[model samples]
Target: MDFLLLDDRTNLKLSIIRKLEQQYSFSERKDVLCEELNISQYLLERSVTEINEDLKQFELIDDMELVEQSSEIILFQDAQVSSSVVEEKYLKDSLEFTLLQTIFFNQFTSIKKYGEKHGMSRTVVYKIVDRIRKELAQYEIKLSKNFQLVGNEWKIRQYFNMLYYRIYKDSDELYNQSDILAVQELFSEIKLYCEEVNTLYLFKHYLLITLERVKRKQHYFLPNSFKSVEFDQKNKIYQTVAQWSERTLKGTNREIEVEIRGIINQLSVYRLEFCDLENDVVTEYTERLKQQFQMNMQLSEIGPEFCTSVKMTIYQHQFITPLIDLTLRAIDLEFFHERYPIIFEMCHTFIYQLKEDEFKFSKKSLFFNLLLVLSQQYDEETDKNTINIYVNFTQGEKYNRFIKNQIQIFDSFSIHFQPVIRPDTDLIVSDYLPQVTFSARNLIWLAPPRASDWRNFGNEIVRINRELQLNKKRK
Candidate 1:
């Protein structure tokens, strides 16, 4: 996934940026980064010089320099840019990227002609295409001799969805202006028929991909095993999609039906489905996942909604797997994640137990998305340690209430804002210098708090929670 979006040089650049990000105080000796990356100090110095230039060129520096340097030390300024933003910039500038975009949108298929258009030799164009071919082949997709993307139409569309997403992002750039307008109307029409079009930006992109693929006479193909699962032809969502297909897409009746089913399958699995509610395979696997997640600390509560969401995720994954897929994903093991370690490990164990040899990205998606949903439904261990806070300001009760309103996180079970000060108060937050002077050990604030004050307030909460844990252990 990383390789697809960034070249080695950009990856190396990002690695440096990430390392610098880990240390909030940005100054690191050039020798330190050089040793960490196992490169020469001179090389590291040169890279730093280039990095400053690259950051400016990326146009995402956002009026703040992301990297700075002295002779011996590289200094970093937090540009507050996300990894995705940086990645899109790098991806857009790649030679292969431009070539592929031209092929997809501009029909620049002839290698020699492409070189002439782009001022590169045919050999260089061939090499770039070869690399793309190899990468796509890894996902069971083929860049054909005529440069057509050949594969299962569903998977191919998914691949193009990612490519277009990474490059254009939320921009209106998938097709020409007229076609973009047409697709927007098509999306609006579908939105009228279905309320699940929650994100217009993403659905617009998806509709464009579908239109482009259908224009190329590419339609959906399902695996034989899945073909056995029966669909309700009269299902409202299915009927709506079929009707839309008739009006919008160019295909035979069967092809349009298959494509419509494929589109429904691409939608959220929680919706009214064509085949999954009673499927034994989906139900059995859902139960198996629940059983596999048995752990020391249970979710404080598990409602019907949580169970249904888990079931539907499994159902969706069951039908969505291909020999390989090209969804843009980067999944990290969440065993040590602070907030949801229990849920993370439980999800990991359940996913590991599944005997099927699935693709890395698919397993990653299941684990990542399931953990996200589980964390939302469950409370953290930290939430159980209550921190009773007394808010006192030189200002009156109304002003104190305003402060509380500013910082209050309603969902946190760990922190409670007490109405009055008590001896049992775990912490004190006050704007009066005299009030917090004696109890500086707990926490303090100013009338107009700075960002660092809020940060310190959070740190105090963590410290109080840790103290409670230690006291429980002593008992």
Candidate 2:
């Protein structure tokens, strides 16, 4: 049987070939195979006989003849995998490149297509893509944008890539592998890093625009700034924004803007550690403004309310709820009169799900009102410890035993909890959480948005009503 032989370094050479194919032509670069073989100066002196027989597994020698007597001669002899066509030959076992091609070409084909091409079962092709993902994780080889990792169609990227590549080929703008990488960098970092609600809105807006253009068979062009963002900066911004958003969504009662500020200061000084700007600088500025807004939680500091309205309607717990409502209203009316939207949202969330009326009016009103009323006094920095201890305690017969206890804890300082009334509504106020102190200066924490708290509270009423129905059924 006439057989082909490869050297011990064949695996490495194959990898180099794959990388080169990703960069340039897979066919014309066939002569450049010597570069990918990477035989060192020391290996030049070693005779083929002296080399270990285990190297035969790589098929380095064919019929015991030196394939190329001179390294300069790029000869093509019979090998296990032929080097005939770019699609069939070069990409023989390269499931990674195959998946990438699908994404680049936007060609959606069934697993059966891959199975038939590779002489494998449909299940085998699925497994190959899965293994490729696991193997290329170090290289960050994402098959497509918007790929969801879990669920039955875990290979969702495969389908999406095929579609995108097909679309790309038809489009006027030519996007090669390098351009794809650049676009990926832009979306993951620059778009994701702009953490401002408004900036995020813009990112979504642009993404929708890009996606829409692609859908309409239009060529897409991202701004030059988007394509130039460095890999490391992109990584940092993505990590920072991801962490910030996770914490904010949790409503963890940490200082929101202060934490974000630290992210900015780190980015500002990142030049000392690494020299690269690209899109990171632009994203840094956006994050900086978001951090600034977060630092100033005062209602008056936000812009003119203009067309916004601060509407407060009582639905439950009429007694104690008034204390919290009236105090927030006082701040809105006297200081942050312009930021009616925020105030209105705050009030809306505060009473989002209270019952219209509870038969036991006193008990109904007091506990329901207490929850919202207590939360109003807490700031962006209120600790979990404080909430657990001072907000829910039911020690004396007093209605707000929790607040009363908290007042003692702060020595009547809780009275100062009345929302800060700004003397100058037009004047925007800013403050900095100073570093170089004994505190954990680098940590900027955000209390997660308790939007769900109100929503869940409303849901709880329905749940209680349902339980009563079930109880009556059993009786």
User: Which candidate comes out best when scored by TM-score?
Assistant: 1
What TM-score would each prediction reach against the true structure? 0.76, 0.20
Candidate 1 lDDT over residue span 1-475, tens digit each: 3345355677777667666655546556677888898888777767767776876897755532444456445444545665555667777788877777776664875988888988999898888887777667756788777788877666667667756754676786547675577666655666665765645454456668787777877777665667323667776656766777788888888888777777666554435454465577777766766665543324434533345566666666656533212344233452325444556666778778876654344666677668766766564222465667888787888888898888676335356787766656777788653333334345567778887788787666656655654354211
- The alpha-carbon root-mean-square deviation between model 2 and the true structure, to one decimal in Å, is 28.4
Would you list the clashing residue pairs of candidate 1?
none
lDDT of each: 0.64, 0.32
Q: For candidate 2, lDDT tens digit of each residue in 1-475?
A: 0001122343344333343333322232334543555554344223222322322543544522222244332223334432212222223334554554453345536667757876888776667566555543422334433332332121122223222332232232434444344334444554444433222222222223333223323332222322221335355664654454444322233433323322232232212222222234333422432343343354323333211111111211121111121111001121111212234344334334334432122332233333233234332323211111112212323533433343343321112221222221111111223223232112111222144433442333333323322232221
Q: In model 2, where do residues sit more than 4 Å from their true spots?
A: 1-10, 14-93, 103-106, 117-119, 139-475
